[model samples]
Target chain A: MLPILIYGTTLGFTLALIAIGLSLVFGVARIINFAHGAFFAIASYTLYLFFITLNIPLPVSMILALISTATISVVMYIISLSRVRGMELNEMIITLAFTIIVIELLRIYFGPSPLGVPSFMKGGITIAGYVVDMQRIFIVVISIATLAALAFLVKKTRIGIGMRALAQDEDAAMLIGVNREKMCIISLAISAILAGIAGVSVTPIMTASLEGAWYALLNGIAIVILGGLGSLVGSLIAAFIIGYAEIIIATYVSSHLKSIVALIFIIVILILRPSGIMGRHHEIEERV
Target chain B: MKSRKESNKNIRTIRKERLDRGARARSKDLYVLMSYEDIAYVILPRVLPPLILLAFPFIVRDTYWHMVFFLAGYYAVASMSWDLLGGFTGLVSFGHSLFIGFGGYFTAILNVWYGVPIWLSIPIGTLAGAAMGTLIFAPCLRTKGVYFSLVSLVAPLVMVGSILAFAEITGGEEGIYGLENPLTELQWYYIMAGLVLLTFLILRKIAYSNFGLVLQAIRDNEPSVKVSGINPVRYKVTALFISGLFASLVGSLQAHKLSFVGPSYFYLSISVGIITMSVLGGVATIIGPAIGAYILTILTEWLRWLGGLRMLLYGVILLILLNFKPEGIYRYLERTYQTFERQVVEE
Candidate 1:
């Protein structure tokens, strides 16, 4: 029981890290970045390619992989999201379009298979009679640190302020000299890089594969939508709720039904309260 | 060399820039059919494609290409429904395979378990599909576009899980194989082709009618539509039913043709491919999805040699198409061929 609790918490934090980026992108850019999942997949894929396949140093490989994903995100932003900015349908369609392209590219190059990644840290420590890996602990630490840093960036930095301004209103932000395009590039980069880190960090636990994008896409979407499309606090809370629920389902029932938990969660929440737990009820009407 | 007589005659002959016969004919709606050219313009586009598609089996003697053509017609039907539901009706479904898979499984169950004949089962399955789809998605109509899409995106995934959980009946991952096909391969092709043409004509007529206009208005602004005394819910539900009916119809056809029904029909890729085909063909154009599906199915067959690169190129092609001309190939052609750009008089 304790093991399940510990595992669920770890899963929750990891999801928080991933969901935060997705939430940020949606909040600021007002576009659902479906290709965010492809970022997760390719980050781990490139990490595998650079670190193991090409025999590069681990740190260098990680940085290079993260950089590569960021580059793709920026390029994707310019090509796909930039022109269709502020329109929900166009944005969603373009992002889904890029997602297909990215996931397909991953499949073509990777032979539609899952590839393993060696652990960043080895060994385990017992906590409450549950043996937990040091790498899992490391992931928890990294996620928390990343979250802290993101909070700081958003609270204290100028670019972060610009992002917040843009999220609230693009025309107003531009009027205040926020540079909407620049803010978009920066926010998308951060979002993509966070996804990259989440994927790379979690690689030791799960083999990176083409379908990882699908998993991340669905997970991120379920979390963000349930927590309200653009609310960070809501996403964080919703992530834990969904994460624990998913883990519990996997543990108690069949793991095959884990995705169904998210599916059901989305449907239930969408039907019951589209604003989510912490979101303003009247921000956007349930019906458009 | 200019003469006063030539200038004066040219000015007089111009007659205040009156429209010639061809120009006048072009100005009138096709319904008028003012001349032979007008009749050709209206009838050619509608007749030629279907004729070519009907003649395809005879021309493409290769078994593989025949299969490709058959699949093209199948995909055309599905994408057309998607274009209607999404592009025209403003309900963007990210996982439309729910209807397709539902159609396949329900038809399979009805035929195999209930001893229903294939002929009877198909229509029954389509009706069941429509009813199930409308019942399930009708509530979601109250939600915004994103939430509606979210429900759609997960509906198939849920279907898969439920199917797997009930593996005893669903056949689970292995799926039910060797269902009956009532017709021979050639007959199936011609029949499917006939169904495809029939679907095209029906959908096109509906799209241009007052019903289609109301649906389009709801897509633009539901409140305004409601203010104008139309229930958006009724139209949205109807659109879903119509769309699901055809999707299910084609899906059942596919299952019988393959003699199998599997959980793979619930795959999101099927939905994605349909959307890609619709967008490539040009959304809202009644026949664009059909054209898009044909081109894509053939493209996939040709690109099979590329192996993994096939999908990469496919993705790239979609990116190019969506980014450059989201209206799709059919609409693009329609605009180019049908549109006139005569200069306006200053008055």
Candidate 2:
């Protein structure tokens, strides 16, 4: 039971990190950004290339991976977003294509085999009666620190205010002389950075592979649907629920049935409450 | 001087007459050109392609390539059926393979378990496919576009799970096989070719009819179509039923040809492949999906030699096409052909 708790907490942290970025993108951009998982995969591959192949230090490799992913995301936004402006279907298709392309490219480069990063912390730590890996504990701490930092930035900084305004109302934000384009670029960059951080942090615990993108995408979508598309607090809660549910289900039932169960939950939730648990039914007018 | 002035006036009159004649000739040419286009697009393909497809297997020898051709023909028919519902109706279904798989499995089970003849089992399978489509997806018509797609996607995954859980009947991951009678590959090829041609001709006739236009209208705007005194639901469901019919037929044929059936045959990847074919060919066009299926089928066969590179290349190509040419290769070809015609006319 203790081990399950630790596992659930670790899973929740990783999921939250991924979910926050998705939440931000959805809140501000109104685009589902299906390629977000692809970005995460790319970040993982970059870390693998740096640390495992080039013999670089893990910390330095992770920072570089984050930066690289951010750069790629910004570039992708410039290329795909320009055409998809104000069109939800177009945006979905374009992002779906992007995800496919990225996953395929990774498969071509790395083959179908899974790769892993060395755990940053080498030993296990005991908390109460349960022994947990130090790496998982580090992940939880880092995730908390990152979320706190993100909240502070959004609350305290001028850019954060601009982002908030943009999320609330784009036209009004523009009327107030907010640089909409710049803020959008910044939002995408930050979103990508968060995904990159999640990717690198979780790579040691969960090996990175082509299938990783699909797993991340499915979890992220479930969380967003359950939590509410643009709600950070809701995302955190949903992630915990999902993380715990998955752990418990896998422990009690067949592991293979976990995806089917999660999918059913999503379908049930969507049919019953499309706006999600905490989401409001607002007409989210997005310029793609 | 008087005689010179008279000659000049005569010359001017002759020039005027020549210009009038030229204008008349140009108008006549335009009429002829329009008639030719009507015959070529509306009449000729309607008549010729089906005839050619029917007689194709008779001309070709019973070789491995011929087997491939039969497979391609089957897919072409199935893909065209998909286009009717998905492309024309703007209802993108990712679980189309569910119908195909259902049809195949139903036919196989009927033949293997009950000793029913293959011919009797095929229609039953097709009807079962149509019923499944209506029961599972027709309710989703109440929802809008993306929601419908989401439901369809989940439905297939559920089906996959159910198939696995009920392994005793389904044969599970190991699959069900050896239901075919002893027939030559050539005979199978001809039989499939004949079915494909028949299916194509039927679909082509529907496409050129007023029903096709109404379906397109429904796709463009459901509320507007409703306001225009048409029941969108009826047309959508009809399109789905027709598509299901063809899917089941193909599935039945596939099961018979391979002498086996499996869950993988009806997997999400197959649905993706169908969508790719339809999109690559140009959605909503009659021949586009057939062409797309032919090209992609051949590409896939060739890519088998390259191992993992095939899937990687396939994914990359899909992305590039979606990004660069969303309307697909068929639309691109149509545009080029139009431009070429204009250039020829101007010259």
Candidate 3:
């Protein structure tokens, strides 16, 4: 039980980090940003190239990777996506295009083999006759700290307030002198950076690979849908629900069903209450 | 001076009336069948494409082109299905591969276990595919906006996980191989051609029918549709079922042609691929997606030399197409073929 809770929290926080960006993009931009997971892969690959291949210190390497990923997001928006800003279907398809382009390009460069980053810590702690790795504990700490930082930034900062305003009503925000295009750029960059950080943090645990794009994408979509498309708090809660749900399934049932658990959770939630547990019901009309 | 100006205005109005009368007469030429040109204009585009498609099997003798033609037919049929739900009903599904996958897997399973003949299994598999897709999506049919789309995007993925989880019965990762290829390459081509034509005509007929009107209404305004006493849920589900049925038919046929069914059949790429084909071909036109599918399939084949860059190329192409030609090639073709533009003097 102790082990499950410890490990589940670890999974939950990491999942939250990955999903919040997706939720954020959908909230503020009204675009699904299917390439959200591509950023995860890019971050993982970036971490692998730096911390593992180049022997850069982990902290320095992570910062560089996050910055690089954010830059890529800005360039991608300007080049391919800025024209299709409010067109929902085109945006989804174009982001899918970006996902395929980014992941495949990375695959060509890195090849298909999985690479691992060294854990931040190298030891374990035993509690209640169960061994808990220090890496897991460290991830939980890092995830919580990052999440707290994000919450603080969004709630307290001017840019964060602009983002919140845009998310609530883009036209209204624009009417009030918010630069809608700039907000999209900002949200996309931050979202990509957040996804990158999630990818970077999990590389040690999950082992970074090109397949992370697909897995992270599936997980991100599942989390956002269950938590509601644009609700940050709801996504956080859904991530824990899914993370612990999977751990429980893996514990008693079988690890094979872990992905299925997330999928089922999405289907069930969408069926039961499409607005999600805590999402606004009004914004649901324009999504189709 | 005033008499001269009035006389000039009368002359301009008389000339404009003469031009308008000529234009209206030309338009009535089609309905009245007054000339060979109008008759040819109306009949040529509709008849020629199908006639060419029918003659394609005989023209393509090479095994490679035969395979290409087969794939074109495959995408064409599937794209038609996608267009039905997405283009016509406005329920954009990204998990359409679930229907195809279900169809393929069930057909393969029935063949492996019950020794069912390929002929009988295909129909059963298609029905099963429709049933499975409908059941999976039924719960979300009443949900508003992109809720259905979101569920659909993940539906095939969930099926993939479920298939892999029950790999023991599902034959695991390699999927159920060693299945028989019941038809020769040429036979498969003709069969696919026939199937594509059949599916298109049926779907086209449905789209023009009263039922289709209701579906289009739902797409345009579901709340108003409900206000008009129509049950949007029932119509939406039926549309999905029909759409899934067609997709499954293609899937079942492809399984026999490929002689195997794998989890790869359920890949998200297939769903996106059909969507691209339909959008590029022209949405809302039952036949346009097939044309788009054929073009794209051949284009993909043409770019086969690019090796790993194929997907990157596909992504780039889709991005460009969506940005520039959101209405698709079908719309362009329909406009050029169906309309005659001439000078109209406004007075």
State which candidate has the highest TM-score.
3
- For each candidate, give its TM-score against the true structure: 0.90, 0.82, 0.91
Docking class of 3: medium
Worst 10 residues of 3 chain B by lDDT: B16-25
Supply DockQ values for each candidate: 0.51, 0.32, 0.54
CAPRI classification of candidate 2: acceptable
User: Can you write out model 1's per-residue Cα lDDT over B1-347, one digit (the tens) per residue?
Assistant: 56988988665655443334344446654344867877787689768987887887777787777777888888899998888888898888888898999899888888877878898888998899778877777767765566677678767867887788778888899888877886777887887789888898899898889999998998888878889988888888888899999999988888888889999988977887888888888888868888889998888887787765655555666677766777788867865665555443442
User: Tens digits of per-residue lDDT for model 2 on A1-288?
Assistant: 887788888888888888888888877776677778887898899999998999899789999999999998888888767566665555655675677778777887887799977798898987895778889988899999999999998999999999998888888999999987788788888988888888988999888887777667767777776777788888888889888888887788756565565566666666676666777755321221
Off by over 4 Å in 1: A286-288, B1-23, B26-42, B58-64, B339-347
Given the true complex, what DockQ would model 3 score? 0.54
Task: Compare the candidates by DockQ and give the number of the best one.
Answer: 3
Q: Candidate 3 has which clashing residue pairs, if any?
A: none
**Model 2, B1-347: lDDT tens per residue?**
99999988776655422123224334646442366663464356458767766666667654866877777887788888888877777777767887888888888888777777878877886788667766666654644455445456556656676677667787788778777566787888778777766776799788779998888887777778889888887887788788888888788778877888888767756776777787789878867888888888878887778765554555556656766787877887766543321111111
True-structure lDDT of candidate 2: 0.76
Better of 1 and 3 by lDDT: 3
Model 2, C-alpha of B38: deviation from truth (Å)? 9.5
lDDT of 1 by residue, A12-80 (tens): 887887888988987777767778888898899999999989999988999999999999999988876
RMSD to the hidden true structure, all candidates: 4.7, 7.0, 5.4
